[model samples]
Target chain A: MVVNSSAELTDDEVDRIFRALADATRRDIVRRTLAGEASVSELAGAYSMSFAAVQKHVAVLEGAGLVTKRPRGRERVVRGNPDAIRRAQRLLDAYEQIWVARIGRLDALLDDTPPQQ
Target chain B: MVVNSSAELTDDEVDRIFRALADATRRDIVRRTLAGEASVSELAGAYSMSFAAVQKHVAVLEGAGLVTKRPRGRERVVRGNPDAIRRAQRLLDAYEQIWVARIGRLDALLDDTPPQQ
Candidate 1:
């Protein structure tokens, strides 16, 4: 099966995900919701910022697929998406592997391994 | 020993790192440099943007510790730091683990595991 994983996040999706997470409040919101789901009102109460501001942050995260919102009575419950976190993590992992492979090739060239013609 | 790891990144540092990585141009610069080091001028030539634009991107990445710049004769060489990538990855990993642990607790509650007194 062609699994759609964070491993296959597009450049645009990657950009949105990182941008959404650049703020401290947003990161805290994610952490809190990840541990336990909460309504927008609950999240807003935890911050000194306005409810609209917290709602806006949630909107950005929702757009990035970092969190999902579902109707719970009159409130929208927010829950963190582990897959989205995994996706961003996978991108960084890929970059680390790239650096490692480059170093490995350089090490081989300095050793007994023959350089490609 | 007082070892400063990405695992201990402050909120401000996390903010900077994620902000620096939110752009496609910046991400590309990171990927290219990770494969091999390149000077700011060389990077400018590869992109259609002005040299100043590319320089700004490099500066952002440098400030976030995502990349490092060093004097190399008339040019400055830019190289991606794998540790920075690891730091951000670790943060994401922590978030994933938080979600996993929450689910684990929920699963235990449904099973024969006794709830905390």
Candidate 2:
């Protein structure tokens, strides 16, 4: 699925991505799937949870665009989507820029420098 | 306050940070405060919402370690915390690595390469 658009993401999209990532198990699933596509059963075998639970986690990752699943011979092979991750990184980077600018202002104030006119 | 802990953050802490960032208004508040420290009243004046609402947003940001508030005269001046943002970036970077590794494995498989022995 096309996860990226030129416009910024909505709040809900960001919420979904972060929420999907909040769980350590889901994060591990993403990590494993990124290495290569794997069947739901294959992934379930590695986890301590039931197959249903792993499937649900995969669904959450899929919804967040973090993982994409394709049917293959009565099984669904899941793959991680790197572009979605890059987009998330971009969002964090923007916030970092804002944060750095704020720190710079504080430094100037502490140094008793006049505002640039 | 020291936001960084050598230990990894707990699930609840991650929840608080993401929840605080889920609102556009709160995100904008972070952006503005990052530019420079500002009194609650000064920030509230810029938004159409009630002062209480803005105050609550500041509280959430502060809880997330995204912003820090210090008393100044009879007011509190809020400043953005860049280190928190950096830590968050680190988390996302780790995810990106996992996603990339998964993709590499898939690519190798697609080329009909045998499993690395």
Q: Number of the top candidate by DockQ?
A: 1
Question: In candidate 1, how many Å is residue B65 off?
Answer: 0.3
Q: Which residue pairs of candidate 1 clash?
A: none
What tier of docking accuracy does candidate 2 attain? medium
| Candidate 1 total steric clashes | 0
Query: Model 1 chain B: which ten-residue window has the lowest total lDDT?
Result: B1-10
Q: Which digits, one per residue and each the tens of the lDDT, describe model 2 over residues B18-115?
A: 66776777878878877767899999998999999999999988988888999999999988777777767787788777766666777877898766
After superposing candidate 1 on the true structure, give the runs of residues whose Cα lies further than 4 Å from its correct spot: A1-7, A113-117, B1-3, B113-117
Query: DockQ (C-alpha) of model 1?
Result: 0.84
Interface RMSD after interface superposition, each candidate: 0.7, 2.3
Q: Where is model 2 more than 4 Å wrong at Cα?
A: A5-7, A44-53, A102-117, B5-7, B46-50, B102-117
Q: Per-residue CA lDDT of candidate 2, range A3-48, in tens? A: 5555688777877776777677887787787766789999999999
lDDT of 1: 0.90
Which prediction has the highest TM-score against the true structure?
A: 1
DockQ of each: 0.84, 0.50
Quote model 1's TM-score for chain B. 0.91
Candidate 1 displacement at residue A93 in angstroms: 0.8
